[model samples]
Target: MSFKITDNTKVYIAGCGGMLGESVYQTFTDTKCTVKATDINLTAPWLSYADVSDYSEISKDIKSFAPDLIINLAALTDLEYCEKNQEQTWLYNALGPENIGLIANELDVPVVYISTAGIVDGKQDVYNDFDEVNPLSIYAKAKYHGEVFTQNHVRKFFVFRAGWMMGGGPGKDKKFVNKIYKQLKSGQKELFVVDDKLGTPTYTKSFAKGILEVVQSGLYGVYNQVCNGDCSRFDVAKEFVRLLGLEKDVKVTKVDSDYFKAEYFAPRPFSEKLVNLKLNARGLNVMPDWQEALEDYSKVFIEDLA
Candidate 1:
């Protein structure tokens, strides 16, 4: 790494409660850095209430801290919620970064914005850092706008696009893996998982550590920051059942997108397979293979199955 992230460094984490934020908070705090954590809902004593959608309030709060670096992980992540609330969605996903970018530009603070692999068209078999973005959903477009605003305003910016994140255990996990785990844990004999959609399942801790390295290495650019390999939702479900020794009881039946059409109406990219090409090229990639990471994650976060 060209630069060192020492304890003396002051970092302002805009969001810090969910699986990803919790993991990022722990990883950075392990470095003994002065991390000021904030969130829309103050989940912990260290986490102050800071609404990302409100530019004035959030900017003023961040300025009081006078951080050397700013990492904005705040966003309206619910795809359907974003689709229904377009204005609020834009405000949180795009305008929030624009606001933070403005603050960073003023204070000369470098900023890191967490984006998603969902911003692609899913037409390709796999997406790399260099692939052209074709955002298919409101959430994707808004996040892409965040990336653009950050690039336009911040002198040093790092946008890391993550894939199907699998961390936050129990109450914090709001994604696919945890959802299936919950269903099976409730004595559901059959679990219908999407087989057509393919993507990497990113472990939050791995992503946090990997992205931290890139940040410390002083590499400032857009990068695909998912786990090393790809799998379908059906594959992930099978792995979950296998890990919990419920394979015998739980039947993971493969289903297509149409199965979820009645409830999950938000338009999703057909596929979200992302490769860490840029990180690999720079020799700074530390993301583990998806299967290895999954095993590690299941040890701590069995989705309330225990």
Candidate 2:
């Protein structure tokens, strides 16, 4: 399981407008690899506009790029939105991956599909790559289907499951960390955070780096790529406030899940933490701790607040 990417090797990344896609692009840039970034909403000059749901478009792109690897990062991750729009969610999250897998399989290229910890049953204390997935939400179910299709259709594929992703994106990121940062920066002094749900907070950059390691190793299977430790939403908010030096004035308050039930009515796994035993056993490095990654992210966005 060892493949080398020289300067001449072409790499294609789907859904390049998202935070993870941005980080993946940066990682590839650092490695000096030939990369083509694509997304349906290609606002940036670096991305090519294409809809993955259209098999013709996907096939055309794969044939034209002739990439050594195709990384599918496109997914509909909004839990509530997906709950309400089940058809759209399934089309984008599940069907898109299946299309990409088919195209990559035809081209004889390895495909790397990004899945989520949400696919796992949160009732479990901890989940590994071998754990049976029992998705609780539409978004999770769609992503789980994508994982299954990728594994079945693509002979060479790596499915990476991540949790509570955090990183920089123009308008693609709307996760817990970004929402809290927005609230704190908009002159909000008080913050109410859920303390019940628990999972690892993954930094997109570290997750991207881990993906590169896996690709280089040429291992074709599922892996959990997330930060080293687990914590609640309240813990993440507290750490964010601390990093911004606003802990004292921010007035962070911990609340039960029922308090925000109205806003987040979608079903969520109470615990989506994933164990990195497989990655560690294979000698691949796990991501940094959430606290450490948050500090780095804070340096970029917190400065704007002041």
Candidate 3:
């Protein structure tokens, strides 16, 4: 609750090309802050090449930036890929935070590390900041380690755990929401959605704004940054079809986990419904409801439906 993120306050981002990262960069930039965004892919011109797993490679530039705060947004987000490449996942998800935490120690800057809802086994109804984590996949385990490292090493940190992210519109969206849109766009008549799974689907822009506000305020700790409400994957797809006016055109069929075949290589928790209990209690809840966020997100890509 000590430092407040201000406009033109030098800031360095480690992963700014992804959906959430893009949202953060755009939102903070809109505030007229001195922002430098970096990514491994270098997909955009504003993004410079930086790998979070290797601190030595990026430590010099990061030090040179002299940022007031460093937000480490880098991670191996692909669950299946993480399962297949365990070592790489560990390096990026776990060691990545550790590497940046070390740098933050030297520079004495607070770090913002994005954790995942995957840390839990999904056996319960909803998870809070106080809930014990039981990661199922390699990605989840590594991310849990990332949170631990951040909490243990970093002098000051904000660990945000995001659930079922929705954003990155056309080309960048790789999550469940965009996946359904792509299938529908490809002229799939019947979309097989997993009804068994349940989680909160969050919009990236809303999360971006929430994180920025938190960064600017005195609240810093673990926060569940998902949209309000909870539902299954089937419900989300149905909403997509309804919002797209494709309910009449596209058929949303409910299916279990087995329907995915080999697509789900890593074992996932049956549910990952994270509640913003702490944020709400502290009056820091800034994200909107799931339905509202979905409507807004759909409006952004309404052309895709057409």
Best by lDDT: 3
The digit string of per-residue lDDT tens for model 2 on 62-93 reads 78989999999988777999999999999999
- What is the per-residue lDDT of model 1 for residues 24-97, given as tens digits with 9 covering 90 to 100? 99899999989999998676677889988787898899999999889999988889989899999999898889
Model 3 residue 172 distance off true place after TM-score fit, in angstroms: 0.6
Comparing 1 and 3 on TM-score, the stronger one: 3
Off by over 4 Å in 1: 302-304
User: Which candidate, 1 or 3, would have the higher lDDT against the true structure?
Assistant: 3
Worst 10 residues of 3 by lDDT: 1-10
Question: What tens-digit string does per-residue lDDT give for candidate 3 at 1-306?
Answer: 556666758889998889888898888888787999999988688999989888898798799999988988898899999989999999999998999999998999888999999899988989998999899999999999999989987888899999999988977888998888888888899999999999999899999988887887756688988999999999999998898888998889999999895898688888999999988998888989998999989875687555
For residue 23, model 1's alpha carbon misses the true position, in angstroms, by 0.4
lDDT of each: 0.87, 0.88, 0.88
What local lDDT score does residue 159 receive in model 1, on the 0 to 100 scale?
Answer: 90
Model 2 / residue 135 / CA error / Å: 0.3
TM-score for predicted model 1 compared with the true structure: 0.97
Clashing pairs in 1: none
Name the lDDT value of residue 279 in candidate 2. 92
